[model samples]
Target: MRDHTEFDSFAAFCDQSPWAFDDVADVRDVSRARLDEYVAGRTDFETWEEMKTRAAEEEIIDQIVS
Candidate 1:
């Protein structure tokens, strides 16, 4: 894996044409109300404990599959 610690500009990184397993899909436009609701729901994580637990669970699942 490449070291991304010192990476800066996102536009420059994107221009590199990085390899990806999945093909890019068209972006879907959504209403502001729907976006707000999604953001609000995700923001409900009350503490780092909950966030870390969720992240660990996701990492475990990813490792199992890949």
Candidate 2:
């Protein structure tokens, strides 16, 4: 969406713990730099690999609904 408030709210939703989703709205409205900062500094993950590992370790990937 073009609205900043909508993008912010959506990004925050995506950052929730124990995330599980097969698809979401394209977030290109949010810059990659901002998204990376959110993941690295705000979230538990320092990198995408770490997020994947953690998800797999917790066995939530397959449990996620498509």
Candidate 3:
């Protein structure tokens, strides 16, 4: 959850792994830049794809509950 951080005019969040998720729809565009950091023995998750899948599941559940 990159803080739902966004870049209206193309700003970089990091020197190497920069990314911005303006909306959930934009989540389709996976940010592999930051993925290596997580996959390098820092978390249970191995890839951004896994995080996205779990997030998508939660979103669906939230919609149903709402």
Q: Model 2 lDDT vs. the true structure?
A: 0.49
For model 2 the local lDDT of residue 16 reads 58
Clashing pairs in 3: none
Residue 16, candidate 2: C-alpha displacement in angstroms: 7.6
**Please, what's the RMSD in Å of model 3?**
7.1
lDDT of 3 by residue, 24-43 (tens): 45545665655545333433
* Model 2, C-alpha of 37: deviation from truth (Å): 2.4
Residue-by-residue lDDT tens digits, candidate 1, 1-66: 012212243233223322221322211244435434432444344433453466578679889999
Ten-residue stretch with the least lDDT total in model 1: 19-28
lDDT tens readout by residue for model 2, 1-66:
112122344345475523443345444455656655655764456654465466465566446753
Instruction: Please list the C-alpha lDDT of all candidates, in the order they appear.
Output: 0.39, 0.49, 0.49
Better of 1 and 3 by lDDT: 3
Query: What global local distance difference test value does model 1 have?
Result: 0.39
In Å, residue 57's CA in model 2 sits off its true spot by 1.2
| Candidate 1: residue 39 Cα off by (Å) | 13
